[model samples]
Target: MTESKADQPDEKARPRRRQARGERRIQQLLDAAASVFCRAGYTSASTNAIAREAGVSPGTLYQFFPNKEAIAVELGERLNRRMLETHGVVFTLENAALPLRELIDAVLDPMIEFNCANPAFLTLLQSSDAPGHFLEEHAALHDSIQDRIGELIGVRNPDLSPERRTHTANMAFALFKAGLGLILGHEGAEREAYVAELKTALYGYLAPVLGTEGVPAQP
Candidate 1:
């Protein structure tokens, strides 16, 4: 006798449920890896520990990531993409002439928001992945970010020499990364004050590019 829909095996639904289970397993692994890396750093974190943390076997973890470094690299790539997109939104030419305080605040606010929202990203930033490897791993996304920053600079300063523009971009990127590190590494009022100071320092440099007033407290 033919079975009713309720009694019949839902072949399509079974595959969908399996796919979801697979995704959940991978996410659990990533989440556990993030926690492990944050506490142990990538170099010392172990696949076995991560698997244990994820409530999975080392073999199961391997199905998702070949090694610890692979997980760290993937996390870094994801974090970098998130920062680029969010920070891009935060700092814009629309505030092209804002004073140093506002400009710095604008630049840092998004970073603070993103880091606070995703502590794993901050942890990923501490990984010892080789230089340019994350960018290489997420090439198209990173390139799009580079292009956006390039455009922002051009809009902010039509006369900045190409060499200077490149230098400025590199400096800004470095400062943003360092700022997040500083903020995440510290605690209490001290971290908040440091972030403010770092923002001012960055804005002091950016003032020239924006053609806005220089930093109020600087000579």
Candidate 2:
């Protein structure tokens, strides 16, 4: 028998609904995997543990991801993409034109926030046991910071040669990463202190090369 027009719409909608639910399930599993990886480390985490963390059965988890490695790789990719998005948002021309202190705040705050919220990302990044391809992907992501920062710096300090700009960007990221580790290691007042100290360090470090704190960049 031919279906009615109204019934056809419902039938077509059914597939979309199923696809949406499937996407949600995939997200759920990935979130669970991230949490497990964060708490247990990549080497110690198992598929069953991730299923438990996700509040799903092992079979349900397996329906989406065949093994723990697949889950870790997918989670790493998602986290990397999110970090790149945050990077893009924070490194705008407006941000680059801010005064030195504000520039440091604008650039570093989101980075620290991203790392804090997604502790699992740090775990995956530091993990030697993660999938090889994922590690290569992450390494490429680290390289993006230099390119982005070099561009931002060049906009402010066009007089500097390309080599100097690259070196400065690398040095800036290194300092920020060092401070980030310290900031993440503390709490409350201590964390705030570390953040203040980081800004101070960056201000001093970049002042000569970039300019004074109160003065905004020309471009």
Candidate 3:
């Protein structure tokens, strides 16, 4: 029997809804895996526990991801993407033009917020020794900071050389990562103190490249 044309739209909508459901399932698995990995570490985290946390069967978990490492890799990718999106929203041209200290604070604020809100996320990052092919697979994403900085600098000062742009991006991310380590690995006043030091180090490094005028005047 021939299907009615009217049903075609409904059929298409069904597929979209199913895809959305699948994506949600994958996200749930990742969220649960993040917690399990954080508590147990990568070497000891079990698929059974992750599956239980996700409220899915082991078979269902395997259907979405082959194993724990795949889950870890996907979670890391999502975390990186999420961080970039959060930072991107906060780091506007106006904020970017702020003194290097303020700019660093802007970037670090969301990151620290994310870590505090999702301690499991940081634990997962700290658990692994850095995925070996992580850089290769996520090179574009990892370099997103540099790319955005390069774009902003180009708009502000067209003559900024590629080397200079690259340097600024590299310096900023290095300090950001170091700050993240201190914040995630420390607690209370010590964390606050480290963040202050990190801001100073980051701004001092970028001041030469961005110039005092480009730097945000206030923190």
Candidate 4:
């Protein structure tokens, strides 16, 4: 006797369940990879180590990511996307009017928090052993951010020529990057102090260009 359709196993439902399980497994693998990368550095981190950390067989890890570089690439892409979103939120019309310190805090605080939470991002980007593609991706992300910064500078100082605005934005980005290093390298009170110093430096440099009245409210 043939079984009713409802009595038979639901093939489509099985696939959907499997896919959900697979996605969860992939996320678990990525999390383990992040921990390994942070501890061992990208060059020294092994797929086997990642698998072991993830409580999965090395074969399982290979099925999802063929190699360590692939894992790093995926993780880097995830981080880059998050940073892009943060930049979008911070560089909006609503934020354009904020004082330089508040504006810088809006941009820098979230970034520092993200980096602190994902140390592997810095490890992969900074490590010489990481894939060249990671560096290229990071460069593109940096360019996008700097371009937005230049636009914001223009908004704040409408009288400044485009060339001057671009120059100031580049300089501000340089200082911000340096501050990031300090923030990541220190902990506790030192990190807080570094952040304060960074804000002071940025405000001092930008205030003159932005004028005493600070960033314009509407632009």
CA lDDT of each prediction against the hidden true structure: 0.72, 0.88, 0.74, 0.86
lDDT of 1 by residue, 1-219 (tens): 878889988899999999999888877887898888778876678899999999989999898899887777776676777877885686566544356566567656876877866777655544556325664654565456566666566666768888887778778777777777778778789888878877877877777676565322321
Clashing pairs in 3: 98-215, 98-216, 99-215, 99-216, 99-217
Candidate 3: where is the Cα deviation over 4 Å? 1-25, 55-60, 115-135, 150-161, 213-219
Best by TM-score: 2
Q: Please give the distance, in angstroms, between residue 182's alpha carbon in candidate 3 and its true position after superposition.
A: 0.9
State which candidate, 2 or 4, has the greater TM-score.
2
Model 3 earns a TM-score of 0.69
User: Arrange candidates by lDDT, highest first: which order?
Assistant: 2, 4, 3, 1
For residues 55-148, what per-residue lDDT tens digits would candidate 4 score against the true structure? 9999999889999989988888888888888888888766667776777788778877888888888888889978888788889999999999
TM-score of each: 0.75, 0.91, 0.69, 0.91
Question: Which residue pairs collide, candidate 1?
Answer: none
Better of 2 and 4 by lDDT: 2
Model 2, C-alpha of 88: deviation from truth (Å): 0.8
By lDDT, is 1 or 3 better? 3
Write model 3 residue lDDT over 1-219, tens digit each, in one string. 898887567877889999999999999998898788777776788889999999999999998999887887888777767766786886577776765566667767776787766666556545545465544445665566668766665544557888877776776777777777777777889988887887778778767666656543223
TM-score, model 4 to reference: 0.91
Q: After the best TM-score superposition of candidate 4, give how far the Cα of residue 92 lies from its true spot, in angstroms.
A: 1.0
Native-to-model Cα distance after best TM-score fit, residue 26 in candidate 4, in Å? 1.2
* lDDT for residue 106 in candidate 1, whole number 0-100: 69
